[model samples]
Target: MKILITGGAGFIGSHFAVKMLKEQHEIAIIDNLHPYYSVDRKKQHLEVIKEAGDFQFYQTNLLDRDETINIIKEISPEAIVHLAALPGVAYSILRPLEYIDYDVKATVNVLEGAGMAGVKQVIFASSSSVYGMMKNVPFREEMAAGKPISPYAASKYAAESFCHVYGHLYGMNVKILRFFTVYGPWGRPDMAIANFIKKLKNNEEITIFGQGGSRDYTYVGDIVNGMGLALKNLKQSAIINIGSGRPISMDQLLDELRVYYPDMKIRTEKNRAGDVDRTWADISLARELLDYEPEVDFSKGIAETVAWAEQHEDFL
Candidate 1:
């Protein structure tokens, strides 16, 4: 199948691109290479992707409605995996308006383009942050995501709604996969795991916020597999979660890290605004729909991530 991946230069997007390419799917990528993180790292991801297989690369911003629509019309992919968005929860707190433009508006543009291009399916990459501070354990897709704590989360939720709109109006299959804390090789530098590893290597102190909340840290490989399954099995509009279904506190994560950085410096502080106490994804819906199961163990996933960060110390 021909697939178009937006933000295909970033962490999860890059991994997914390689996965699709390896599966012998025709691929086209659109990424503005936003400096929200290191452009060098994204470029490195692109290099790896190119080595995996041949694909069309377009450095186009999704915020440009006309250009994005034209690009989609030109590619006319059978499906679109929308992954581009402004990330960073705490950073979103500082510049909330940008979330509207980058996340919300950008998603609408993608959906608009997909609908206009007669795309058959759209797989939106949502986030667990949309679950907010819900007291429920193992969040379910049916749960109300109306109360997002961060602008980033709110934008994702809004984007999910627009995806449904396009699905309904355009007669397309839209699958909204809410990813739990994704981490692994080529992980985002701003993420907690990457930050801790980088700080440990730099002999700097790692800061833990609040009671050090837990997260269902899902592996990037598992995430890409889930997306592939969703693309194959989904026949209608649905919302599902792609996660490990395992929650680990910050202490547990640090304990795993201590295996490598036995003397890792640490400090504590109040939880930042828009931070959730814990996130645990109930992936039963995904199993029922796509037979999705997370294969990577948390300890092993962290080990791989640390190894990658160590190898790419300059990038980190």
Candidate 2:
């Protein structure tokens, strides 16, 4: 199948692109190569995908309607995986309008373009942060996500709503997957796991927010696999959680890191606003709908990520 993946040079999207390419699917990637992190990292991801010899890439932004529409018309892809967005809770707090412009408006453009191009399916990248501070142990898809504490979460929720509208009004098959705290190779450096690992490797103090708050740290490989399954099993518009069905505290994660690197240090700090105290996903719906199950356990995934960081010590 020929597919278009937006933000395919970023962390999770890049991993998904590689996985899909290995499955012999033709891929066209669209990424602006934003300066959120090192552009060099994005270039490296592109190089890895180029080795596959069947992937095409476009350096563009979804906000430019003409460019995005033209690319879609030319590629005539059967499906789209929309992953491009300004994605950071703290960053959203600092720059709310940027978040709204990129996450919300860009999504609207994508949906409209896809509809005009007669695309069959779309898989959206949502976030567990949309659940806010739920009292439940594992968040369910049917639960209310109306109380988004941050601009980032609000934009994602708005994007999901746009997808739903497109699905209902135009009969588009849409799947909205809410990802938990995903980590692993090619992970975003701004995320907790990657930042902590980088700090530890450099013998710097890793900051702990809210005295070791817990999170459902899903691995990137597991997320990409589940996304592929969701794309394959799309029947109607749906919202699902993609996560390891368990939560791990920051203290526990730090201790595990110590086992790998005994000299690791931690510094406690207050939790930022709009940050959830904890997140655990109820993945039963995903299992039933997409046959999705997280394969890489937290400890194993962290170890693998640490090994990768060690090998690329200069980047740390």
Candidate 3:
């Protein structure tokens, strides 16, 4: 299969690209290399992807509708894994409009381009944030995601609506995967695990928010595996969650970190805006539909992530 992965130089995108390349699939990546974090880091990711296998890399921003459409038409990929977006819930609170511009508009442009090119399938990466503070413990796909607390979540939900619209109009198969709290090697620096490690390494105090809220911390490998399965078996449009189905509290996360940082310091603060009390994904739908099961244990994943971060000190 010829696959076009947008934002293929980012953390999860790079992992997925490597997986596809190794599977002998022809891959093309579209990335703006936006300095949301570090262009140098993204370049490093591209280098790693190159080492995995040969692939076409297009430095195109999805925000440019004309260019995005033209590139898709030129590639004419059988499938598109749309992963480009400005990610960060807290950051979204500060600049909500940026989410509309980068997350919502970019996704619309991708769908538009895919529709124009008659692409067969589109796999959109949504977030657990869309669930908001549901009364239920484990969030299900059937649950209404109408009250997104953050602009980032709202934008993702809005983009998902566009996906269904495009799917209905163009007869394209769309798979929306709402990923849980994803963490792993080559992880984003802004994420909690990475932030804790960075702060600990620098002898700085790490702050715990909102009585140590829990999250279904899914590993990137599992998330990528779920996506691969979705690509193969999903014959129609669906909204499914790709998560570990195991919720880990912040205190538990810190305890895991203590194994690495015995002398790490900590403090407490109120929950930040746009933050949820907990996120637990009911991945039974994924299990039933795609035979998806998370393989990496949380402790093992954290050990590997910490080890990787230690080697790549510059990544922090």
Candidate 4:
């Protein structure tokens, strides 16, 4: 299959691209290399992916509707994995409009562009953040996600709704995957695990917002595999949760850092706005639909992530 992956230069997208290439699928990537993080880091990702497989890469922003459409038409991919977005819940609270433009508006462009190119299937990347601060233990796809606490979450939910609309109107088979807190090698520096590791290495005071709120920190490998499975068996328009079915707290994540840091320090602060109290996923739908099974254990994942941090000391 010829696949088009948006944000193919970022952490998860890059990994997914490698996975697809390994599966012998032809892929073309679109990425703006947003400076939300170091563009150099994204360039490094592109180099690594290029080493792993051959792919065509277009360095274009998704918000450029005409360009996005043209790129899709040029590639003429049978399927698309829409993974591009400004993705940070806390950051979204600080920059709501920017997030809306990048996350929501840009997603509309991708879906519309795909529709124009007559793409048969779309795998839209949603987030567990759409579940918001639900009191429920395990978030289900059927639950009401009407009250998103953060602009980031709201934007993802809006994108998800647009996916459904496009699917219903255009007969595109859309699979919406609500990703949990994904962490692993080549992880984003802004993420808690990576950020905290950086602070730990620098001997900087690590501030724990709301005591490092817990979440279902799914490993990237499992998420990528689940996405591949979802793409393979997508029969209709569906919203499914992709997670480990296990959630852990922020403090626990801190404690696990002892494997590397052994002597890091942390302080607790008030929770920031738009940050959820906790999140867990009910991935039964994914299990039934995609035969998705999360293989990496949380502690093992932490160890692996810490090892990556050791090698990429600059990221820390």
Q: Per-residue alpha-carbon lDDT of model 4 for 1-316, expressed as tens digits?
A: 9999999999999999999999999999999999999999999999889988999999998888899889999999999999999999878888999988998888888888888899999999999989888887888888845889989999999888889888887889989999998899988889888888788888887888876677999999999999999889767778999999988987678778876787777788898888888889998999998899999998999888878887988655
Model 4 stretches astray by more than 4 angstroms: none
Q: Sort the predicted structures by lDDT, highest score first.
A: 3, 1, 4, 2
lDDT (CA) for every model shown? 0.93, 0.88, 0.93, 0.89
Return the TM-score for each candidate structure: 0.99, 0.98, 0.99, 0.97
Is candidate 1 or 4 superior in lDDT? 1
Q: List pairs with backbone clashes in candidate 2.
A: none
Residue range with the least summed lDDT across 10 consecutive positions in model 2: 307-316
- Backbone Cα, N, C clashes tallied per candidate: 0, 0, 0, 2
Q: What are the runs in model 1 whose C-alpha is more than 4 Å off?
A: none
Q: What is the lDDT of residue 287 in candidate 2?
A: 94
Q: What is the C-alpha lDDT profile of model 1 across 103-181, one tens digit per residue?
A: 9999999999999999999999999999899887879988854999999999999999999898998999999999998
Lowest-sum lDDT 10-residue window in model 1: 136-145
TM-score of 4: 0.97
List, residue by residue over 1-316, the lDDT tens digit for candidate 2.
8999999999998888988989999999999998878989999888878776578889998899988988888888999999999898999999999988899888888888888889999899999989888997889988855988899999999889999998776688988999999999877889988898888777889887786679999999999999999888768779999999999987788888888779877777888898988999999999999988889988899988988898876554
Clashing pairs in 4: 198-316, 214-249
